[model samples]
Target chain A: MRRNKKERQKQLKETIMENPFITDEELAEKFSVSVQTIRLDRLELSIPELRERIKNVAQQNFADQLRSLPIEEVIGEIIDIELDQQAISILDIKREHVFSRTHIARGHHLFAQANSLAVAVINDELALTAKANIRFIRQVKLGERVVAKAKVINKEDAKGRTIVKVKSYVHKELVFIGEFSMFRSNFTETGDKQ
Target chain B: MRRNKKERQKQLKETIMENPFITDEELAEKFSVSVQTIRLDRLELSIPELRERIKNVAQQNFADQLRSLPIEEVIGEIIDIELDQQAISILDIKREHVFSRTHIARGHHLFAQANSLAVAVINDELALTAKANIRFIRQVKLGERVVAKAKVINKEDAKGRTIVKVKSYVHKELVFIGEFSMFRSNFTETGDKQ
Candidate 1:
């Protein structure tokens, strides 16, 4: 059941694309190869290590033109966005994000991730939160990967407001949810008034 | 009217305590002295530069046992906190917090600052946000100082919920306001359930 070198390399590339944070040991186990073999395949494919891949993905997605806010302010890595339609972001809770005493991820970090994604999904020159209703369903821990998905549910053209719905999950279990009422200047006939 | 060196140095320390990010040039203008004199006074008082002072505040406030969340996740410098009573925090928006195309600060950063302060005010080991209602009153820009104050408005011991009201201002103008409903495990007498 061993694939050829060329086939293995192609599959390796695909796997990394699907999950940039996958470690070499995990890849080796999945591919039924030694760690050295996995490293060699990665080298042949010109794939960098896990950290580099993550950094590259963040830099590439965030360096360009964001309609509403900067990538650094998004609170997570925006893997995909379809301007005012749908968006997805991934937040990896680190040591700094958890309580030193309890080791649970702070609630605001989760909220920040979800709220920022909601704002980033809007297609506008200026987007501000008029109001937000949010709920935290579960306590997230350190080193967990939280994926937040945002969708524009309603757009009020006359009022110049857009409603965004955001839900965050850790391992497919809901951790947080938010509904954001956003005011976008671009949607208003008045030119750039706060 | 230029004051004596002793009087000027004493006032300099108070000014820095009131606003930690005040530049030496501004201090000089206020004190009717040169920037060099301000630097000398700072050296005499053993006060570090503005950058170092900000760093020290962050490190000092975050390194201790925070009642609710970690210091690094708070999104601002917690200058003062009295458990379950009130708290004050400072957030300085920088280049990383604003859009590359626009200089306005992202809305979530402000939200994060306010929400975290709300959680940190609770005097409990485990405090979770059950719900929140928030409004962004105005847009914040880069290099602005956001000061957030959180006050405990309600505590229902039977319901095991506490309500905190947070108001954030940039130069005394309200920028954001939020009301957070927090659930604390200690209030329930259940002995730490998730």
Candidate 2:
């Protein structure tokens, strides 16, 4: 069905908002239009590109939704967040993040970015990472923008540990996975330092 | 507490074997000798510097003790290992491991060196990391040599999951710590892929 340009443009805006990382080719395929038409529609709607949209979302979200840690402490920019619930952040790997011999992004940078988002999701005044089980599913290369999403999976610990699940991806491909155990400082009962 | 050079050099060899990361200055303090005297003693005894000693140990250990993963697959070189009991590896962070602007070592390399040691300590043909709980105690810097030790804490699981404890240090200061749950391929009954 061929919808009017106005209707198509409105739907396009919704689609982009739903998945900010969606590529123009994928959007064109979904909207049943040429790539050029999608671009033209996006231009007419004054919606910035995916990169700009991500930046806008991050800058806007970090101002109010973040409470557990300062914004600068986060390894990546928080693109979206709901404290004590879920948060999303993005990190762009550069020359310094990868091995000089091989362009694979260092694993700790990815973990730092994801772990920072995981730590940032707590609503408490201070959250300390108690534990994490993680895996590197794939190698991330330099220049790739990794998006990490951290969600609170469990907060029912009697000892006050909130389990935050963090998954980082290069676009849609899963690159790293981790579950972080964050402890609220006020409820710290962990004395066995092993 | 001061000893003659012959006696001190004999003890120094043993001390270096026990802790290969010990520096010349520390050896001097221990032997009540000047730093240059310690260097002269090391040369007389054909003892390599700390960096060379570490590389030698890793190469020697990898040739005989490594079983779970290939030598290349392990991120850092294994300096010492006792199969399913415990293992140690070393990673020297360089310019590639830090933020160009900050010079602080990235976190994942620390995890990788530890995680790899955790995996290498397992005696199985295929051991997969099921979970890891880790913490970064301090920011690592470029030019730091990270020594990660992994020891199997428990292997008594009915379902065959082994818990490995990994601790990474820079000159005896804790830089990173993790507890890794490794799943051997033969023992995997994990239908719940969460």
Candidate 3:
């Protein structure tokens, strides 16, 4: 594994490309080089740091991630996401989100935030909510911020639907929860479900 | 199985109270009486006809039914319902229901109609959505009316939750669908779910 600089740098670029999450220390250990040497080689290869790489994986269309709709289509600000795995987002409840008389956040606003997050977490060209089961644990008041988390239950089921579970919280208290069955364009059906 | 007039009238009222959807002919056959006699007995008992009885079962709290909430709490005008069974309602898409830019009906409005209908169909003093799965098949337009139907899937599960399914339609085309798990006040939890 002790190759010259040119060969090591070439392999280093390929390694980082294959696994963007590999840290500098791990890369150094893999190549039997110092962490500083690995860092220098990464700079020459124009590879970003691990944190940036993870962010890029979620934000950019690189590595076939984020192939769904544009981020603007998502209702809230997505702070963290890993395609086909999990994602988190935040939404500020405003006047537009509440009932005029009750001042309670509408259930569907919470649903849309969760639905769009589920769609965003799928690494496919098209992600649509075929079915969803959701509940409001408590009334969300106006001016409160709702934080939503989405986790993919199954990458693809036998019926060619991706299952995602979402939970929405206001101030760490559970306010809403939902399970979404997503239909992705990439999966082919076994010819039973419609 | 013939009875006196007073006894027949008493049993007729009890039968209608137990099952509001029962028809006059069915009641006559059950009592071994003529349809005319059944009608006379119902009249004497001040019990309304089958149609009115079904409506009263949904609207009034005469028989431990319609206890979840008042009819005013339901989002749309309820056309038909049988507690812990099935229900139907219609929501006219007005100016307030649509998004200004797209002129498309907001998804939450449809969900609210469905959610409230689901809550209405539960035969309990309190019904809260513990979870729901929903999907929007097509976007509703500004002027289109949405018809939502709710059906109780399970009267009570082992976890003491009632499963309700709802589907919304626009001009006979499916627009939205949802399956909700409702927590009811009357059904005591067997002590597992939260």
Candidate 4:
């Protein structure tokens, strides 16, 4: 019975990894174990109860993508947070930071820096971007320091939706502006996920 | 004259990164260097000449934002590419590969897997996403092997635009479907960049 339980736990871990959203009842029925046992197994595996798993999945994906790229020209760090609503961070797009390219860092870099700061500030683990609309109002020449500010415009937990507004500037001149809508979910539920 | 020249080159590199879309002659004038020196600098930096830089700078922004997260799980690998139309990759989402508050891998993982494949298939370095619409059709449960596929639907070089369709499947059953619009720019006459 002990060996059989260990094997069952291993299988359960595999199942949860493949699809972190499977419920306790589902696991119990599939593995012929009580729901309580399955919960215990989850705890043993160090998997975040349920909410942590969902959020970790999203954060992990972002980290994985970043690892695949080659970047050498970033001068910013996230400094603040506001849970699920919004975040703010500051960046110093230095003049001599040779960006592996010949031109100025495009507007997207600024937008991306601000967006990542916002993502980090969101307290949840599972947040996916639904929409991002941005406008480039001014040019951000080299050596000009910039500040990025992001704020959540709307959040509906029941509906699993959130929106954010991000703006970047250099010495009071708007350089980049954007609005993003993120899809949030807890492993216990999955629906209308677009 | 030697020190002045070196200082001018450093300034030019910064200016170029800030305005990757500028003409070589314009950049030369801005930094008091010959266009030839700018060309040489671009080559040293492994970047394209001029026109390409402009196009590249416009599109490669938000992608940088998503890549700021840290790596904890990698469930997919891109396999092949077929021009400006379609990209194909394979993914193995396992139970142990999960992260965050949610147990299930976030939707962005699947999206990033598909998006990265599309970017890889592009001939240029900078591929900017204009729009991406996705639908979760079925539950991608744990231990279920899956595959992701992306196909470009449209390409418009003059406006720097490309549209692609993405789909994920398990055992031949569709699990997710998506549409992505990405913009491409060469960044200069030198090379394709992301």
Candidate 5:
């Protein structure tokens, strides 16, 4: 009595959902199939590579809540978080992330990822970027895995402004660096009413 | 007596040097050639569209001294500047900018763009990004043309921290927003210099 491929896939999905960051070999062992079989299953399910899936799911759950938002120019995901004084995360870069015939993606993409992570820590639904001065030191290639790390340098409650610093590195080399300011708007007054 | 194509190209370069933002039609008329001919001249000179050329020239003049500096993540140039509490500037986005990748370039690119503009206002060489937050309400597309606007929100003299805010828009429609914190570092005391 053999189960249908659809049923097997469904089971696999559930298992992966339990822990989306499983290794291919582990998935193969659990499924009683070859690594190739597990890969095919993932391909059929449209699941990205392991790191990408993990990042995407993290972004969907805790990063920007705009997964359903109909805005263009969004494709990065958050991998980790630490609020307030310490903000940091790991991000993976891909070719699809870049516009056609360009050395790197637009500057905004990098800013948004780091900014979103910082916002997630703000405990507010509406946050605004106040100011930032950044520098680009290198060009990120396609499909290269990189890390985006940020932190809070200063805060002022009376003035309602916070200062943040972020750095993006490729293979341990500091590629891009930025310092930003974040303004947190009260969710009650903002349009993101629940 | 007829000027060869090379001579005409030289003249065009000089004209663009004076007014890089000149329209294609204006350039064509000035060169006594059709728009198509002028376009060909641009391509031969390795210059982008009118808007891109404007940004290129503006960035060149703005960061001329720091052009030799190695920055990895930034993609575009600072076109105009205004300073006060946090400082602000008008930046033009270019498609050829790096960070446009499949999953490589994140939303932070825009944030970094505005953030960098803010930091440039600082009369220091090295400022670190301490923390940042951002919201993605809209998406920026390739060749769509956008403006990055940033402002300072807060600063802590004791801690040497500054806060900045940034927003990106395509034709006045908000595309991305961000907040950042920058830390002023005096590298002179350190052994290495940026």
Candidate 6:
């Protein structure tokens, strides 16, 4: 059954919220409406385009949570983060990230996504990688969306070291795994150094 | 002492070859000429802008040497490489690579440069990372030029694994180091699968 314009607009907003990267064509097909209608509905809802939406989500969700580094420096878009606990990030491989002839995504990009997430999860003024052990399980192709999950495994306040494990998946299949030992500077209360 | 136009143009080409990312303003200062004169010299030499020159150098030097992947996939500009022996690359940390508020270069960018250099040094039809041990010795700042050198330390042909060590430096100061264990696929002659 087709939804009325009023109902469809409400559902359109929900759909975009669910998947920010969905295109106008896909939304029109799903809603059984003209592409023009979808565009008009988006304009009325004050929703930006896909790229802007991605940037906004990244900036709004995880920017302030970062203490050691700025949010813009993260290699991927962070969707969720719990300081000193866990974090999740998404990376979409584009043409520039892939080998020109083979269209295979470079392994370093996957490493970057995982490594940055591990650093971003720290709750300190400075987080640096002391050591990392990593593996690439499979080759990723262009246009693939990689979801990386990073968890804090251990923290040693006396030594000022934290251990984080990161795993990257493409369509639920693991592509890379890494364990990072991070070094953080000592900080005291009142925002002063120890 | 400033050379004449012809001599300066020839020296300009050589200078760019030595430092692919030299800016027009810097070139003008180095050659004791106006920026406009430097631009004209580049035009006569059929040289593109700084960005294009970097891209061209990356493409022209390493494109054909790659056996496992395309050169464009490398994180930095590969200036020298000897398959399974050694390789060197340069990465310039620009504004986009740094934290917006702090101007500190992201750690993952440094890791990407080192990790990709390790992968590019392997001589095989396919190279994948089995494991990597890495360390960030210090924080890198924006606009720093990082030179990463990768050397193959060991190879276990029977196990299909090669160990490579990469060290990255900014102005001769060590910033990052990594040891990578890479897996190579078995391939037969005549470009046939094993």
lDDT of 3 by residue, B103-149 (tens): 66656678789988988898877676777767778768888888999
Q: Per-residue lDDT of B137-180 in model 1, one digit per residue for the tens? A: 77788999999999999976445779999999999998888999
Assess candidate 4 and give its lDDT.
0.59
Cα-based lDDT for every prediction? 0.83, 0.78, 0.80, 0.59, 0.60, 0.82
| Per-residue lDDT of candidate 5, residues B1-194 (tens digit) | 33589998998889888887789999887778889988898899987888887666665665643321223323455555543244344445455332333221234555556656655555455554545555655445555555777676665533456667777777888876766655555422222223
| Model 2 lDDT per residue over A1-194, tens place | 56889998888888888888888899889878899998898899998887888777668668666666667778878778888889998999998776554576756678789877887889877665666778767667889999999999997476577889998888899888988877665675644322
State the RMSD for candidate 6. 8.7
**Residue-level lDDT tens digits of model 5 in A2-121:** 357898899889988888889889988877888898899999998777888876776666445332121223234455555565555555666545534444444445555555555544
**What is the clash count of model 6?**
0
* iRMS values for every prediction: 3.4, 6.2, 5.2, 9.1, 9.0, 5.2
Residue range A1-194, candidate 1, lDDT tens digits:
57888898888899999999999999998889999999888888899998898878766765564678767778888888888898899999998777777778777788778878887888776777778989887788889999999999997744677899999999999888899988887664452235
Candidate 2 docking class: incorrect
User: Deviation in angstroms for A82 in model 4?
Assistant: 2.7
Model 3 off-target regions past 4 Å? A1-67, A70-73, A82-85, A94-106, A135-143, A173-175, A189-194, B1-77, B81-85, B91-110, B122-126, B133-146, B152-162, B169-177, B185-194
Once superposed on the true structure, which residue ranges of model 2 sit more than 4 Å away at CA? A1-79, A82-85, A89-113, A119-148, A151-194, B1-65, B95-106, B137-142, B188-194
TM-score of 5: 0.42
Candidate with maximal DockQ: 1
**DockQ of every candidate:** 0.37, 0.20, 0.24, 0.03, 0.11, 0.35
Rank list by DockQ: 1, 6, 3, 2, 5, 4
Error of 2 at B135 (Å): 4.0
Task: Kindly report which residue pairs in candidate 2 clash with one another.
Answer: A107-B108, A108-B107, A108-B108, A132-B132, A132-B133, A132-B134, A133-B132
Which prediction has more favorable lDDT, 5 or 6? 6
Q: Which is superior by TM-score, 3 or 5?
A: 3
- Encode model 3's per-residue lDDT on A109-136: one tens digit a residue: 8887988798889988766666776777
For B1-194, candidate 2 gives per-residue lDDT tens digits of 89877788889999988999899999889888899998888899898988898777768667566666666667777778887898888899998766454576655567778877877788877665666778877667889899888889997476578889998889999878898877665565654322
TM-score for each predicted model, relative to the true structure: 0.67, 0.50, 0.50, 0.43, 0.42, 0.68
